[model samples]
Target: MRRHVPGVPLQRWLLVSALVSAALIAGCSARSSAEGATHYLLTDQPTGSEATATGGEGLLRVQRIELARYLDVEGIVMQTSDVAVRSARNHLWAEDLAAQLHRDLAQRLSNQLEGVRVLDPDQQLRAPEREIMQLTVTVDRFQGRFDGYAVVGGKWRLLDSEGEIQAGERFQREQALTQDGYPALVESLKDAWTSVVADIADGLGGAWGR
Candidate 1:
């Protein structure tokens, strides 16, 4: 039996289809935040380097440590052929590498500096009353050598509230990587960052009469 009924307008039908497609796409795109998350280490209580003089008196106490600026936190600005080789084996991307390094430093510093307030780099920009201390870290070079070795090195600078330079230092550390690829590289980088941070802390403490 043939029957005739009112039909939807062409424009109305098109809109309906578009809306339905969008809904489907949104539903499919939903993802859990922790799906591929990685954990990082923090230096809650850092010990002074052996080279640091232990007998220094009149150490000044820091009221706070602020990470007030990250205008130039570019991830993976430099890479080497060794990085490509390791990436192929470990399936690690440049962004992931940068993120892991950043997380490790943040956590370690937060733990090490107790009683002192730690400010997020992004949040520091909003509050004018608080003193602003900027720390800039640059991964100038990262490579794994063929002599059964891996090395990571970089430069960092600290600036005071008025944008005056406080202290600057460079560090490099290398270690032998096992079968693991990116993880090994990360570990080596962590070691390098630890050394660098300790130096910065010691220098700051000395400058402030601590």
Candidate 2:
């Protein structure tokens, strides 16, 4: 027989093991929290019938349309709160409206035109091309009424490479209150822009000579 040396109790050992496990779990959670995260979502709207052409080459061709920097309009403004003290969503100022329009144009062109390529302003400026089409868009009005109606109005012009006006048109769209607040207003405005672009694209495509 050999003399047994004093040893730590099993209860203490178990407590130590549990504590270590808890520490490890906590550390892992902390590390995970420290890592940055990102989120991506699709925000494209559906295509509409306005872009459809009657009869053409059956196969669509890609084209580039240059956008003007500024437009002649009253500018964009948002209305958030109602006179009735109801909470209104955030209203869209001018910059937001412009940005949304740009995005919508890009998406629509990509969807309607095969192999569509939208050149950046900088890129277009640097590139040398024989002929280019320029689209000048102007927002004449974007506002919400006290009666809960939203409206958008604008004019656009298509110019050829020689700075001759090919075609120009004006459009206006209005809708009653659907959703609650600012987002609803924004959606309405976007819809109006989409309609206008579709009309313009169809009109311009027809004017293109083979």
Candidate 3:
């Protein structure tokens, strides 16, 4: 004869099952929260009306852009202190920052410089027969600061069709954020970038004998 074991009560079994399910759900929720990220694109805001072309005629090619190693990542960077910096884990660029900057600068320059066509060499729009001015930029600082400013610092070189340097200058600008948040930071950065482009346009005008 064998002895019978005691069975667990149905109520106790159901309670244990419920607790296990709840724990699993909680773990999954936590994991999802950790994995979720916000993506941002550095794009131009639409103007109410169409922008008219304003400058002289020429073919300008934006060559491949370079960025600092720290800025090569997708995460948005911030300078926390004089010696410390941090990259946001949740906030990231929606597109490659270097490519986006190249496109943005090209578009802005095209719009501001009348009669001139700005081409991104990466897009393969260059014509060998036509005279083309090449622009190469290397950005070292593109980030937010602890003092509520968005800083952009870089050096740009303009090369003539013969590959001779026409004009080269270091550009730096810091625009104060109107308020706080990533959106504000991005807007300020755009403003600062636009200013830099304006400076380039001025230089280009002088160099091109416009």
Candidate 4:
């Protein structure tokens, strides 16, 4: 027969059970906190608020936007050194970076260039009679630098409907972050990108015949 052993006292058992439950709850809470991430959108306003059309005006298709491989990831990238970089573990893009760039650039172009409607890669159908021009861009660098500046480096070319290059140039811009952190970095990036759009608009003015 099994020897009769003193069972844990009722009060002691209750206290031990409560302690175990509390420990489990704390563990789960810590795990949840560790796994949660914050997402940020590139645009200041909602995506739906971004207007892609200029009331069927002159067409300018923004296409062939190639971003650096490192920048294509979900998290925002930061250049730790000339040869080293790291992506944020807790901060991430709210949408695809490429798509967000295209849409936001197109919308900015539409606003910058009068009488010209901007079309992004998403626009598949072309207007039959409207003259079309395209802007192809390659972004080599788009990240926060260790020097505490947000940088955007790239090249853009304007091509006519017949696939002839009209005007193009290599460009790079940097904006100083007013404060630290990812939000400030993103804002500086937006300002830098807007400067790029303004340059493109100026180029378009000289390149387009109409």
- Please give, for residues 1-210, the per-residue lDDT of candidate 4 as tens digits: 112225644443333333233323433565644877668887764233333434556678889579988888887777754687766655678898888877777777777676776776767665446767889988888887665678899999998889999899988998877664678778888889878878977888777553
Top-scoring candidate (lDDT): 3
For model 3, residues 71-112, the per-residue Cα lDDT tens digits are 998778777556766666656799999988887777777767
TM-scores, all models, native as reference: 0.50, 0.53, 0.75, 0.74
For candidate 1, lDDT tens digit of each residue in 1-210? 112223644443343333233323333543522243233232223443212112322211122232213212222111222233221221223344554456555544455443333444554334344445566677644544433234556776667777677776776776554433335544555565677666656655454445
Worst 10 residues of 2 by lDDT: 83-92
lDDT of all predictions, in order shown?
A: 0.43, 0.47, 0.72, 0.71
Best by TM-score: 3
The whole-model C-alpha lDDT of candidate 2 against the native structure comes to: 0.47
Which regions of candidate 1 fall more than 4 Å away from where they truly are?
A: 1-90, 93-95, 125-130, 178-186
lDDT of 3: 0.72
- Listed per model in order, the count of residue pairs whose N, CA or C atoms clash below 3 Å is 9, 0, 4, 0
Clashing pairs in 3: 54-114, 55-113, 55-114, 57-115
Please report the TM-score between candidate 3 and the true structure: 0.75
Model 3 regions lying over 4 Å from their true place: 1-35, 45-57, 122-129
Q: Over the stretch 40-84, how does candidate 2's per-residue lDDT look in tens digits? A: 111356564324323332222223333233322222233222331
User: Which of 3 and 4 is the better model by lDDT?
Assistant: 3
